[model samples]
Target: MNVTIVGGGVAGTLTANYLATRLRDEVRRKEIEITLISDRDKLLYEPGLLYLIFNRLEEKDILRDLKILLDPGVKFVFKRADKIDLENREIRLGDEKLSYDYLVIATGSRIVPEEIPGLTKTGHWFYNLDGAVRLRDEIAKFKGGKIVVSVMGVPHKCPVAPIEVTFLLHDFLKIHGIRKSSEIIYTYPINRVFLMESVSELVQNLFTEKGIETRTFFNPIEVDAEKREVLTLEGERERFDLLISIPPHKGSKVIIDSGISDDGWVPTDRYTLKVKGHDNAFAIGDTTDLPVSKAGSVAHFQAEVVAENISAEIKGLPPTARYFGKAMCFIETSFNEATYIWFDYETQPKFVKPNKFTHWMKIAYNRMFWLTARGVL
Candidate 1:
């Protein structure tokens, strides 16, 4: 039996490792072959993008080459997938076509800055590697002007990223000795500052103590590149030296075109990670519209279930593993301190106090990137 996986992000790479190691016994017993295809040869460490954005980390330090992670039994196809042919149980990649008995689609979302007028041409984004690098260079040249960090829409990757960016900006200005001249403002579309009321209250309090301005219930309409202005729906005009914006995020057009996803995201059995309307197709990570944060931890958790289920099915046994919506994040408040929040669907988020242990833990996790690249982690 052959298994095909698409995407090389946290979901795909972690899943590959799990299946290759923990399920090696099953693979050898059942003669199962695994294949992973992706456009890039590297698995981007997204959480470290924040450090890259601030120029504290180098791009080379965070990028994990995928070739180093694939097991000998698993073949890696380096190409962009053009189409998903569900009828033939195959995937089209340019001139090449690959067939599989079981398919997993994990091609993640992208930031469509062009979706909003003048956004791509004017705004600075820090969600991806490229955007983070661009923002880093731009922030360095900034001579103390209004820096507005804003969100375009919801269902974005790493919901706390924008908040973290704002806090970092506050620290950045103070370090550069321009805190008085540079104005930092954070704006979002949500009614609350964060998804949870308790967390939102903490964020709002932090903003107040830091003297960073807050704007809620506001939607960005367009960016005036020539005039360096952001126009909102309420006709409010804000002049900005750098508009750090999170562009509108959407799922892969291929998933939408193939009619596998609703509004570009695949609707799956949240408990099983199985794509609806298909028995053999599964989805993991940001590709699925799960009621959880579209973060790496959630993707890793989902992959654990998907890998176990795939092993069970290969043995003609029922999938006994179930997925629970669990996600946690270490929100970096500053270089000196951070808070770790752990939560699930059944329980409210519990915030842990800032300490050196978490900072060291974060540092240790960053070091794991190198091991993960070599398929050791």
Candidate 2:
């Protein structure tokens, strides 16, 4: 049997590595073949981008070669998948076609700053490597002024990132002796500061203590770069010297072009992690339209379920694993302190008090993330 996985992010990489361990016997017998397809040759630790923007971590510290991370039993294919023919169980790669008995779609999301007019030209973000590098330069040159951190859309990867960046910016400016001259403003689309009420309350209190201003129900429709203003759907014009935005995000174009999902997100079974209507195919990570944070932890937890189920089927065992919307994240309140939260489908988030210990843990995880990609953690 041939198994094909598309995408090289945390979900795809971990799933490939986990399957290698589970199906080692079958692989040695030459009865099962595992192939992972990715467009890029390097796998990036995305959470490190937050530190990258702050110059706390360098580019080389957050990237690893894809071939080195994958298990030897898994074949790595460097190619961009053009379309997935679900009916024929084939993946189209430019002029070539690859067939698979079982398919895993781990295609992740992408940031679309162009979706908001003028944002591409004037705004800054840290969602991708290039954006992080550019933002780092901008942050370095900034002296003092009104800085705005806006959440333009929801379901973006790393839900707490906006809050974390706001806190870090405040600390950064304070360390640079510009806190007294700078004003920090945070904006969110909903009436509350965050989707989780508990988290919102905690963050709101922290923002208040840090003297950071917040605007609720603020949905940015367009950015007037010339006027240095952000026009909102609520008819508010917010001024800023520097605009750091969490731009709108969308799933892979390949998923959309293949008619898998209208908006690129694949319809997935939240429990089994299977693509809806296709038993032989599965979806995980940011590619799924699940009501959960599009964070790495979510992808890591889901990867286990996908790998286990697929391996079980090949080994003639019942696949009983199920994902329960498990996710965990570390929110940095300052350079030396952080807080942590974990929640599932039936649980509400309760963040721990910010402390130095948790901050160290977050730092330690940054280096250990490579082990995670190799499924050694």
The most accurate candidate by lDDT is 2
Where does candidate 1 clash, by residue pair?
none
| Alpha-carbon local distance difference test for all models | 0.83, 0.96
Give the Cα error of residue 182 in candidate 2, in Å: 0.6
Candidate 1 TM-score over all chains jointly: 0.95
Candidate 1 per-residue lDDT over residues 1-377, each given as its tens digit? 78888888888887777677755875667687788888889888888888888888898878867887777656788988888887789998888888889888887787878888998898999888888898899988888979999898888899888988898889988999998998998888867778789889888988898989988886889999999888888767788888999888888777877777656788888888888877888888888988888888788778878888887888778889988888878887877778888887787887777677887787788877656534465
* Candidate 2 accuracy as TM-score: 0.99
**Model 2 local distance difference test score:** 0.96
Please identify model 2 stretches exceeding 4 Å from their true place. Answer: none
Question: lDDT score of model 1?
Answer: 0.83
Report the Cα RMSD per candidate.
1.8, 0.6
> C-alpha displacement of 366 in model 1, angstroms?
1.5
